[model samples]
Target: MVPQEAYRPDAGAMTTAIHVRGLTKRYGDVQAVGGLDLEIQKGEVFAILGPNGAGKSTTVEILEGYRKRDSGEVRVLGIDPQKPTREWRAKLGIVLQTANDAAELTVRETIRHFAAYYPMARDPEEVIAKVGLTEKADVRIRKLSGGQRRRVDVALGVIGNPELLFLDEPTTGFDPEARRQFWDLIKGLAAEGTTIVLTTHYLDEAEALAKRVAVIARGRIVAAGDPATLGGRATAKAKVTWADGLVETDTPTRTVLELSRRYDGEVPGLAITRPTLEDIYLTLIEAPE
Candidate 1:
């Protein structure tokens, strides 16, 4: 386990965007989080990847001030989330897996209503346009498709112009095109300096958006680093593939050079590949204590 001090310091000129130490949560006898420690910098797109019932949701809920922890130190944007003030609440945005249904309201109407809660809310029209729902802005919530409804949910989340955003499987029900569009939206928000904390089962999503990622299992962080190199993935052995066979070895360059010698210069259908995030993720989840 990482020491509590390691995850303590704030990042950037403003210090840390989020600092957590010894974060533990329990539901009856089941420990949801066990001495978790984490530090996220400002303007970073950090991802949390974990298997089902691994405490991902529990941790996020605590950070969001939706649940209380058994014992821990948590500072989100320099304030304890468990004791959120109105100002602190305004700085944070959350897109949960499921949003409440505003059945009788139009997409635009719903956004406008939610915006009223925040002191520094963004323009309702702008929020709608940003989430790519301008075309459906007039449609009632009960009449829009699932994907469109999800967009409305996102619109509400960012309506406050929050400094940090929490996205929990934001694209779970999206189709391919919708997912791609949503990714772009997230990128735009991050580019504008919104610190984002994402939790998703999609390894591809984490690889595409997260500047850094943490993998959790059994309520503990097993690995945390840049997605490309987590679990020594970038430095790990490469798989050299040819028309007839494949070989996995640490020295892929040497293997390719040797294959060239046998093939008299050019090996047929030759390609070298390294383990993908998905591959590493599955292995990490399946490994035993």
Candidate 2:
């Protein structure tokens, strides 16, 4: 849900779905988030990544109205999250890192019960099918596998028909297949105009789904941009590999062209690669705080 007392947007400002400026949070001497600023457009799948204790969760909690910020301005759907109201809460859905236990209830019963909380909830049967849990609808919660249980968690999150959805490390325990299915489900939701904010350690997952990514370290944002071009990544040097050895440089195309002349043909095992999101992320996090 969102806060009702935050600034109200004019018609033109409504284009941006989420906006945060100089956001900060502290616990005594420790700073959890230091003057963080971010903006997300509507219907965009944005990913936030960070090392442990980097204030990622804290920032998200503030956005979700689960926790209060010490300072800074934040807005979601034109409302301040800190002053969350019923109408604002109704427009947001959240899937936490861990779902609560309802061990004795069947999957269908659980979803049905939660659906009653929303004024415009999705159809229970449709949500179950969308999450690939139609077959487990009648199965008891305790008997379901970990991945299947996660699907149930997603079902509950979307049952509210929220305009914005927050997912924190959603596929932590899923296998490859289940993870793919979940990614597809997220894409489907975004396609339907749902704004999504996600946090995860899986760089590959971020690359696959996020239109843009933000990397945080030591309670501050280190880098933010498109996944492929974060931190000048697209313009960074490429690593060139050949049968003899490998070399890294900014002019990969020139290197390949010269190598082709030297070899009089295609160079054996010739490959060119740029730094991956994970590589850049690790480098950013390990830098001096």
Candidate 3:
């Protein structure tokens, strides 16, 4: 797995969707956060990738104003998260790693209840439809399967018409098909300008949805950038191979032309390959902390 890295937008006085500096959190002798810094732009889909107990949750919770940080400066929507107001809280939505156990209330009922907490809530039924729970809107939450229940959680999270959404391992237990469907829903939300912050162990999920990604390890950002270019992958040489020879080069087009001339036509079995997200992720995570 690729070890963790984080986003480094720029350093200066400018407002961003999320801004953090020197963030730290500790529990007794254990430090959960160690002088971390981050920056996320508005309308951006950002992912925070890490393994279990890598301080991903702690960082996110502090951003949501649910956990107190020992020290740092945090601004979400240009307002300090540590001093959150009711309006500020309403603008943020969260889908936790684990949803609360469902009760007898139907999906529609649960969503409506949560919606009422915000001043400007999206239509409950509309949100339900968006999450692909329209057919099960009236089904009791207790009767839904795990994937269905997760859809309901998503429905409730977006029902508040939040400006920013936090998804912490949102698709944890989903099957492949369900995961794809959920990805579409998230894409739709981002298309409409909802800033999303996701934390997931699934490298594929992060690469697919996030515009930028940060990998965390040992309570600090180990890597951060465009997933395609992070850790020098964008500039990383591709292996140009054929039946007869293998070479690594950045200028594959030029190499291919030469090979074609020498081969008297197309280079047989010509292929250019670069490191995949999974390969980079494993190397990063397995590195010394």
TM-score per candidate, in order? 0.93, 0.93, 0.87
Tell me the tens digit of each residue's lDDT in model 3 across 1-289.
Answer: 6334323333322337898999999989989899999999888999999888778999999999888999988989878888989998888998987765667899988999998999999998788888888898888998999999888878877888998999989998899999999999999999999999999989999999998999988788889999998888878888999998999998998999999999999788999999898778778878995
lDDT of 1 by residue, 1-289 (tens): 9887765553332757888889998888998899899989989999999999999999999999999988989999999988899999999999988865898999988999999999989999988988888898888999998888888888888999999999998999889999999999999999999999999999899999998999988777889999999999999889999999899998988998899999999899999999999889889988997
Model 3 residue 189 CA deviation (Å) reads 0.9
User: How well does candidate 2 match the true structure, expressed as C-alpha RMSD?
Assistant: 3.9
lDDT of each: 0.90, 0.92, 0.88
Estimate candidate 3's RMSD in Å: 6.8
Tens digit per residue, CA lDDT, model 2, 1-289: 5665454566535778789999999999999999999999988999999998999999999999999999898998888998999888889999988865998999999999999999999999999999998888999999999889888888888999999999999999899988999999999999999999999999999999999999999888999999999988888889999999898998888999999999999899998889988889999999996
Model 2: pairs clashing at backbone N, Cα or C within 3 Å: 1-89, 3-80, 3-83
In model 3, where do residues sit more than 4 Å from their true spots? 1-15, 242-246, 253-270
Residue 53 error for model 2, in Å? 0.9
For model 1, the stretches where C-alpha displacement exceeds 4 angstroms are: 1-13
